[model samples]
Target: MTVFLIRRLMQAVVVLFVMSLIVFIGVYAIGNPIDILISPEADQIERERAIEALGLHLPMWEQYLVFLQRAVTGDLGRSFAFSTPALELIVERMPATLELAIAAMGISILVGIPLGMWAGFRPESLAGRAIMAGSILGFSLPTFWVGLMLIMVFAVHLGWLPSTGRGETVEFLGLQVSIFTLDGWSHLLLPAFNLALFKMALVIRLTRAGMRENLLMDYVKFARAKGLSTGRVIFVHVMKNIMIPVVTILGLELGSVIAFAVVTETIFAWPGMGKLIIDSINQLDRPVIVAYLLITVSMFIIINLVVDILYSVLDPRVRLKEMKS
Candidate 1:
């Protein structure tokens, strides 16, 4: 297990290194920030000073080295647009994004699994068919569109929820979180639901498929033949077996949810990392852009590593295979 973890950690380091190079080069290629930062009528001397200040005059390799060095020290540099530490800005917004992602995933898991289990057990029933049909619609709808419709119905028409922003927040453990406050939760509901729709559908389908497969396995029959209660057989025996895939998907999807919540955040004007990154992009804020990308890549790598570790824990077969390798 230790050897396997070390191997995975090494692989994660390599992946992050490659990802940083791609992000740095890609951000540089987009367009010089100096063009947007300075007035068009700015003279050559002014342009040169700005370029020098930003280290743009250095060779690409040298700039990358400087960036890498600073990054290693947790200094991601300051945002050109905000003139603030890029990491600080991102950290400030992280809570909202995290809250949204967690809420969305919670919705997916809580609602999807039970419905999927029911559908898998009773595929021919009316309720099961309805759940399947709803899952299809969830997949078909776009997040932004769904967000808008939600805002229209819940905020504009019914006036039950706020349409935008993280509402009232309370400081918990030195971080401001909205989940504890009524106003905050009301504001959170629409965006979280919209963000969760597709993932919910995906979970439903995956769970249903897993359940159907597990239900037919010999152990299930054996459990039944042993006179175990149907509920115990299905919930304990089937659920444990089916959860391997669900947990894998959930881990990976959590990363994606955080990364891809940009659209939903934008639509809802949520004060999160996604919204901040979008603003940074428009202003050509390379520091923030690079920081965000690197952070995102790191998150993905970490989540995947966690998922791999979880696989071994959930299934002894996986642990044995890793040990053998």
Candidate 2:
């Protein structure tokens, strides 16, 4: 376990380095922020001063080295647009994004797994076919479009739920979240459902596939031969084996949910990191953009590490394989 963790940590460091280089270079090529930062009529000396102050006077490589130095000390520079530390700005909005992502994940897992298990257990049933069809539709629909339709139907016509924004948040454990309040949930349901649909469909498909495969394995047949109750056979014998893959996919997708929630946040006007990054990009705020992307890369790496560790714990074969290596 120690060796495995050490190897993963080393790999994560390399991945972060590569991602930082790519993000810094890519952001630099977007456009000169000096154009937006300084007045067009500013004198040459003033322009040069602004450039130096923003560290644009240095070569890109030197600037990257400076960034790396500061990053090693837990600094990713400040947002040019907001005049705040990049990490601080991202952290402020993180709870909103995190809560939304987690809510979406909850919906996906809670609803998708049961439906998928039932569909797999009774593939020939009418309800099973319907569930499969719904999953396909869930995958096919665009998130933004679905969000709009939901707003139009629920908010405009029925007036059942709020159309946009994170509503009525109460602070819990130093983070403001809406999950605890009824009014807050009314605001969350639409966007969370919109964000969850595709992932939910994915979970459904993954669970169904695993269920079908495990059901046909020799152990399943042996359990049946022991005259175990059908419910016990399916839930205990089949579900346990199927969970290994299901858990892996869900763990990785959790990172994606937080990282790529831009469209849903945009449509819903949610005050999350996704919206912040969009605005930063539009304003050519290199620090925030770079910081956000690098942080997102770090998140994926961390989640992958967690999933790998969970993989070993869930299946002893993985630990054995790693030890042999």
Candidate 3:
């Protein structure tokens, strides 16, 4: 186990290095921030000073080296647009994005699994057909449009929920979270569901397919013949087997949920990192953009690593295979 962990960590380091290089180069290619930072009428001398100050004076490789040096000490550089540390800006908004992503995943897991299981159990039933039909809609509709429709119905017409903002929040475990307050939840529900809709449909489909396949397995029949209760056969025998794939998809999707929440965040005016990154991009804030991308890459790598570890736990054969390899 220790050797496995060490090997994974080494791979993560290499991947991080490659990703950081890509992020830095990609952000640099976006355009000269000096164009936006300095007035068009600014003279050559003024432009030179601005460029040097922002380190555009250096070659691309040189600049990346400097970036790596600073990054080694936990400095992601100062945002040219905000006059603040890029990481600090992201960290401030991280909690909101996290909460939204988690809420969405929770909704997907809690609602999709049972509905999927039921649909699989009785695929021809009216309720099962309805569930499947809903899953199709969830997959087909665009997230931004769904968010807008939600705002229009709930906020514009019914006036039951606020259309934008994080609403009220209370600090818990050093993080500002809205889930603790009723006002916060009222603000949270629409966007969470909006973000969750697609993932829920995916979960429903995957779970249903897994359940259907498992129902016909010899083990299921054996369990039934051994006088196991239907609930036990379903939950303990069937659901347990299906969870490997479910967990794997969910683990990887968690990172994507955070990264791609940009659309939903923009539509709902969500004050999360998604909005922050968008603003940074428009301003051509290189430092903030680099920081955001690197952080996102790190998040994906970490989540994937965790998922690999989880695989061994879910199926001991996975660890045995690794050992044999």
Q: How well does each candidate superpose onto the true structure, as a TM-score? A: 0.96, 0.96, 0.97
> Cα deviation of 163 in candidate 1 (Å)?
0.5
After superposition, the stretches of candidate 3 with alpha carbons farther than 4 Å from their true spots are 320-325
Q: Candidate 3 on 1-325: residue-level lDDT in tens?
A: 7887777778778888898898888888888899898999999999999998988999999999999999989999999988899999999999999999999999999999999999998999999999999999999999989999999999999999999999999999999999999999999999999999999999999999999999999999999999999999999999989999999999999999998899989988889999999999999998899899888988998898788778789886788236532
* Model 2 per-residue lDDT tens digits across residues 59-87: 99999999999999999998888889999
- Residue range with the least summed lDDT across 10 consecutive positions in model 2: 316-325
lDDT of 2 at 145: 89
lDDT of 2: 0.91
Alpha carbon lDDT at 38, candidate 3: 90
Question: How accurate locally is residue 247 in candidate 3, as Cα lDDT from 0 to 100?
Answer: 92
Candidate 1 lDDT by residue in tens digits, 1-325: 6777777778878887898899999998999898899999999999999889888899888999999999889999889988899999999999999999999999999999999999998889999899999999999988889999999999999998999999999999999999999999998999999999999999999999998998899999999999999999989999988889999999999999999899999999999999998999998999999999888988998888788878888877886344532
Decoy 1 TM-score against native: 0.96
Itemize residue pairs with steric clashes in candidate 2: none
State each model's C-alpha RMSD to the native. 1.5, 1.6, 1.4
Best by lDDT: 3
Tell me which of candidates 2 and 3 scores higher on lDDT. Answer: 3
